[model samples]
Target: MGMKVRGISYYDYMLLLFVGGVIVLSFPANLLRVWGVPFFRGPYYDVIFVIFVVLALCNLWMSKDSPLPSYYFAATLLLFSTMVFAIGVIRGNENVIAGMKYFALPLIVYMLLVGRRFVLSFYSSNFLWSLVVGSHVFCLLFYYAFLYGRVYPGIGVPSISFAALFFLAKQKYFLLSVSLLVVLLEGKRSLLLALLITMVFMRMVRLSVVGRLIYTILGIGILVLSMYLGLSFLAGITGSAIVNRINLLNPFSGSFDILLGSSGRAGELLSYFRGKDTLELLIGSGSGFTYEWQLGYASTQEGEIKGYFHMTPANYLAAGGLLGLVPFVWMMLLPFRAGALKESNDTRTVAFGLGVFCVVQSFFGFNLATDAVSIIFIIGPMMLLSEQRRPGGATALRSNSLERTS
Candidate 1:
């Protein structure tokens, strides 16, 4: 247990570096621009990304055994991604390589978190608490920026995952309340909805009738208060009457419209292959081909906007076609499998909830653009694999063969 860095026993140093990378990546890029901090710009983020990738590769090579099924599945997915990238390269899709860098770099971090021993040395309650605190700091910073009418690009998925982990730890619900408020203010309706579902599920499974009753009452009160406060802030910004702003917050106001629109989009995505040749339909337009197929944001740097399919399955199908879609789908599901195999009941609950949340979110959000979110979605549940063995730990096979011989 004498984990050392230089002369100091700094086993947690890897954890510190990982958190630092998250913090650096989550820094308000807009502020850097306003301050003319060229040194803290894009390449700074890339440097940290490169460092983690190198570290992950090193750890992977040195790892004696894979800790989790998600690790193996994720590695397989990464290989499939590489094959897709190779397809793009062969076809001379010149920018495919550049576009994939953003998608691939975060994945390296995901791999490191799951597969690296140093990072996973003590992924217990204390580790979860550290993540929760870091997430709260992240949430607070993002909210303050929003209050000032400055929208900085950052991910709330980590905050949401941390909140889920907090519940799994059976802590007082104070942090959950704060997390909900921050997410509401951030206006990520999908994640907010997922949080609501997760809370309901957690309450049903973990709380008694009386506890659930109290939770329900408190949750309703919090929901109403959050809506009121959120609308008031928006009213202040838009100079709209308070009453009118409240109307805009109506839960049912656009439900039907959204459902219809989403359905229509899903239909369109599914039918996109109608006129394509069999080869194109099976192999896709090519990896990163969505760049030519979709729209880009005006403010995003030229060539930086990864195309969006608005649906996860569609995105994969369009990018990798059938060839790339299978492993991607399996990768998404492996979290649930990993969770189911966990010994802890709470781990199973959280892993399944987070897995469902991520799957649902993918229906509405773009994957490549939300790299931070995707990382949490993949690795959050994957943490459950820390205690698992590789399918009877090398002796089961011998035992089975012996039985067969008999």
Candidate 2:
């Protein structure tokens, strides 16, 4: 028999440790820069990437199972990466390595997860709950100790959002509230939107077919109205920065123009395709391609910078063109595969909700491809899918369920 620790197999325990390390190290390095902490930068991510790739290869070597749908998802990402790299070569882009790594990171993680024959149940594991709570505690201490309670985007928002979804599915209302509060403090609008969408998905999945159709029709109008009233209330009490962001939704104030102007997405898109030939448009300028955009006063002395677009659609289209965009969309939709959705079990539903959260967040600026925090979103659901395919997997999952606390 395999060695076990506290009833978990040695390999499963190692997986948990790997996930915990990723969570700790995945905080935005830019935030640390403000405090003069330079340790958590590019090389740290490279180390994690190397570790994950090695684990994936080992798992693949040990497993003898047939290919699953998640494997196809990984393959698609690989294909997208290959296409981007080839186009980069043709264009002789010198920054291809930098661009290709973004796409490759997700591919390797997905492969690592899909290769696993067994995975711990995220819903019932006490270890996961403790890990999440511990991370949040550490975040709070760090904020108070180092940053003097200053709030900025990317203070573990992705990991906290994932924790929130897990807690919500488990009906751990208190922990969910804490997670949401942390996310709000981090000040990421995308994470808030994702949480709302995932909550709706969780509720919808439990209803009957007809009930879901009716709920969908009614829910849209209610959701919009509630959001308007809620945001309006929040604007009154929140900081000016958040209030300014909320004001971008006001159509009466020409919010669309303000948004487009502020984000520079429209200008970026126009600049990207203005002079491209048909063939170039079809396959893109490759991964390392960059465009010049005006910068805010705080950014640089030159008043402009050259970089990739922040918007996912714009970035992917520029890097891989139409050929790359299709697969990116497919990879995002992998969580909704029929087999994963057919069962409404708590574990499956929670995994599904996290998947939805990531997909929704991807549109705004969440780089599912490059962000290390995205590992949970891919791993959780894909592991469930793998379990579903294994014989007696459902029973095994049921047995793994145990009471957990904050």
Candidate 3:
């Protein structure tokens, strides 16, 4: 039997610690920086990640489970990273280390989780719910008590879209409501859109094939109508910063420039591809690629800022071109493969929902492969998927042993 502590398995606590550490370190690290904490530095976060990885490796080493999925994922990431590194070397990129860190960290986290055997039971779900909700509560308190009504996007919490979907899939309405409220108060357009889409999706997926078709048609019409009417209504509202920001998106203005100009992403995308030659366009400029783009929307400073694109497509295109983009897209769509969505179990459903949310939100600025904390949310579900694929649904012996000890 696995070791137990206070009626809970040591392995379960380790997983909890891993998840909690990411939640604390990712967005809340910003809070630490504001408070002048030295531990907010990159090395500290790296240390936590390293510890978790080492622990996971040890567990995998002791287990009798097949490691084929882990090997395949690691190989794929190695190939991609190698290509990016080679291109960076050839192009003499100075920020290759930073670029590779951003590109490889999430993939490594995913690989580690997918390679392991873990059970997502009631205890796991409750632990995740409490941890995520507790973090949001603390962030909300800090936002109101310290920031004095100023909205700092992602200030104290990483993207909660995956958690929100998981809660919704499990019919944990209270947790789902709390997650939605947190996202709504955060006032991130992309995140709000992603959560809303997830809510709609969970509802639609429960319907029959014909019902889903009808729902989609009706949803599109209602969504369009709502956008048209809501934008106009919201534009006239006063004293709300989020509404004021929403007012800027005037889709009826008959000009793409007006709509896309607000985010400056259009300008960034254009500048990214403007001068690329055929070969450079095919394979990209590699990691650490930077381009000059006007950042008029920025609050702190405005002008030409040289850095990576905020959009995932632009980032992937600039880093790995079609080779990177195709695989990235395929990875995002993996949760939708045959038998994935057919799982009747709530835990598996949560995983399926998270995969869908990740795909939808990728278009809006979330990058699972780049954000370490955000990627942690997908790990459990993906591992569950891997387990389900095995003949006779191989049980997670570690988790079972731990349960027995408990």
Candidate 1 per-residue lDDT over residues 111-144, each given as its tens digit: 5555332222222233344455555557457556
TM-score of each: 0.62, 0.82, 0.80
Pick the winner on lDDT between candidates 1 and 3.
3
Residue-level lDDT of model 2, residues 348-403, one tens digit each, is 66666766777777776636666754645645565665665677766555444333
Instruction: Look at candidate 2 and tell me the lDDT of residue 246.
Output: 48
After superposing all C-alphas onto the true structure, candidate 2 shows an RMSD in angstroms of 4.2
Cα lDDT tens digits, model 3, 363-396, are 7663664565445444445555666567644344
Among residues 3 or more apart in sequence or in different chains, the pairs in candidate 1 whose N, CA or C atoms overlap within 3 Å are none
What local distance difference test score does each model get? 0.50, 0.63, 0.60
Name the lDDT of candidate 2. 0.63
Candidate 2 lDDT trough over 10 residues, lowest sum: 294-303
TM-score of 3: 0.80
The full ranking of all candidates by TM-score, starting with the best, is: 2, 3, 1
Best by TM-score: 2
